[model samples]
Target: MTTTGKIVIVGGGVTGLTTGVALLEAGLPVHLVAAEIPGPTSVAAGAMWGPYLVEPWAKVRRWSLVSLDVFRGLSDAPATGVRMVSGIEAARNAVSAPEWNTLLLGFRECSPGELPTGFEGGYRFTVPLIDMPVYLQYLLRRFREAGGTMQRQFVGSLDEIDDGSVIVNCAGLGAGELAADDSVRPIRGQHVVVKNPGITEFFSEDTGLSPDLVCIYPHGETVVLGGTAIDGEASLQEDRVAARAIVERCAAVEPRLAKAPVVASRVGARPTRSEVRVEADSRSDGAPVLHNYGHGGSGVTLSWGCAQEIVQLVTATG
Candidate 1:
């Protein structure tokens, strides 16, 4: 538990911050460097617990289950901006319960009336819905309290972070350049935030297999409507066309959304890979490194577990 060495975490989104905080709390000196920490992407996440579109389903399920419990506990802390909300995932076709459903709270098959029209089958469950901006602030606060420090610096390469500790690469899309990972591409996502319209629960149509994206997540006084997933598109430019489509599609699920006044619109490019890279690497000089990025759309879902894994990996050799 002593300060074995200084750990440098690259990237400032959920993954980087979570890993940095975990390592710092484990009594290791940690520092974070990033071009945009808590940048557009992490803040623009739909920020749900579902393991949507993440590969290597086994590992993702394990990580997601761990994060679910952690976020559930954090829900009690007002500043964490996490809450256990019950919601129904309506599927256009019949689908069996996902294996990971058992790990969640209040799992149930929805009755016909419980389902929104056009969804032939669905399930209801309670999962952690995070208000990302608040949660990130809470994470930064906790990390500072744990003696972690951050620098707003850009890292052109891992060698630039050689400060006597293994570098943990949570650099997200930058991995395409930072780690020279060509497999890492961006899945651009957009969201529409509107007045809550008194919606208390959440609703999402499982469009994972389909191209259409439709979801309504109500957090307090606002509902986060989402989204689009266009692969290889890294543009952060807001698309008014996409925004209107998101609202129109979301309104189909919840009628009130049709008249809700639009509050804001945002965009983010999810760093995606066929499988998330969470393993050890080495430099030409054999300097140890840990790669943990390319989470696609499930960074929030897998943050805690992956962060904990980073801690274990560091401790095993520290």
Candidate 2:
């Protein structure tokens, strides 16, 4: 199952692009094929550096920490669209600190006065807040600069690709059909973008298993307010009602947002599974295939770590 052929990566979202960059930097020949580059799901993310609604806690924690380290280094370069921002993540109900709190900078328990009106418990920390649109482009440029090639084509099946090259599937939601894995499903997320009202920090309400989420991530001039997480919803169309609710919820947390004018709206269907799948498989023809998808809402948070693991798998199998 090993030969001297270039690595063929499927899907051009953050997962695929980041994987390509890692492989190319590792000095492997790589080519990417996807239906869309800077995938809508990745771009639409209100991408803060925190593991949300992801599973297999032990591995997720390790992967998230690895990504956090990379993002911290990237924060120094503004062109990468990664910024170290201070913020509060509080919940309406009393809660204990998360085990990963120690991994963040400036980790502290929020004083009662610092907690927003309804939040009964929370924490203060500094983490990378990625502006996805800019960050995705950065990844693409880095990928190309590393001598990686890209082809804009939809992959209907893994068998269709018979180039004799090892395949890495990062098809996100599309993996459901491609891998015939029924566990993968869509968790639709919507967010509202508004002109920043001089806000420099981020704020998020810890919405435990609830479908409705409240988070505000500001990217300089524009702030992304999110959102709703409806399981089994795959539509990418913007929901005006959801947009308005997002703005209202964010405004309730930060009064200045009440007057902020609407800049745009975004909708993305997060590819979710009971647990993230990052394993190796072989096609009927014996070509090795690596699966790297189902990061759920933490695609950006887990990208680098997952990619690094994929590179390891490639190295190990060879």
Candidate 3:
């Protein structure tokens, strides 16, 4: 049976939607309140790969793995836009890095001939990529069917929730304000969407260049080519210089993409923190408040695992 009290989830991004879906599936009555209209992350290029220049949180990786499986199991909602993708990682340097090396499936030494670059070896593996748009709609539909209620009301504070109700803060960067988390800063990521190049794989490079770098992932109708990680930058404006650099870099990697037409550009701020917060707080009336944001560039990569833990936190509280 479902629980007795109402559970309100804040933020309409991946974390909020996934938490709502999990709760509803478990027969819990849920209500979602957001100050903004839901749009893009659900329809993202959806590539779930990781272990790059940065050392990601272990829990985050675990959650991403679990989410990878969940997205893989769903068949009917092909539009939820999830798919398993094989990826290749190559470095221009010969130095071996253990942390990133171990994350791949076939972590091995590449022959000189195979090592086609400015220097080093390579690795390969497969992971899930979620089409955020399809997944978001699917989530909304599922929540509605399970009797969950959602509104466009922007919650100013945790006290705005009713007494005795559990409030989950999944407001993404908005949590910096909503949860009073000063560490939550916006890491802006910009992408260029192009017509499909008929490529099914994902390729990325990390030379630690200037304003941007190249990341190419092919989806159902289009290919995502881009990425500039501008920390503390909140401007949603498109960076054409960065966009052109990305296109040029990507085209250099695989010249075929050069011919594809640019359909659109996207800018999203990855909510980053020194540590991803997923703990319980309390409303003024002593109602439980669960904080679950800060997945940064890995939100899609880590949704389910985080939601599962949040469910456990809420369940244990009762």
Best by TM-score: 2
**85-139 per-residue lDDT for model 3 (tens digits):** 7765567765454454454455555467753346365555666655556667777
Model 1 earns a TM-score of 0.96
| Top candidate, metric lDDT | 2
* Model 1 superposed RMSD (Cα): 1.7
Q: Candidate 1: misplaced stretches above 4 Å?
A: 1-3
The number of clashing residue pairs in each candidate reads 0, 0, 6
lDDT-superior candidate, 1 or 2? 2
TM-score to native of every candidate shown: 0.96, 0.97, 0.88
Ranked by TM-score from best down, the candidates are 2, 1, 3
The per-residue C-alpha lDDT of model 1 at residue 118 equals 87
**Full-model lDDT for every candidate:** 0.87, 0.91, 0.72
- Tell me the lDDT of model 3 at 175: 83
Candidate 2, residues 1-318: lDDT per residue as tens digits?
A: 343689999998999999999988988899999999978999999999888878888989989988999999999999999999999999999888877787776799899999988889999999999999999999999999999999999999999887737899999999778888999999999999999999998999988888889999999999999999999999999999888888998899999999999999988999999999999898888889999999999999999999999988887753
Instruction: Give the runs in model 3 whose Cα sits over 4 Å from its true position.
Output: 1-3, 37-46, 51-56, 75-77, 95-119, 208-211
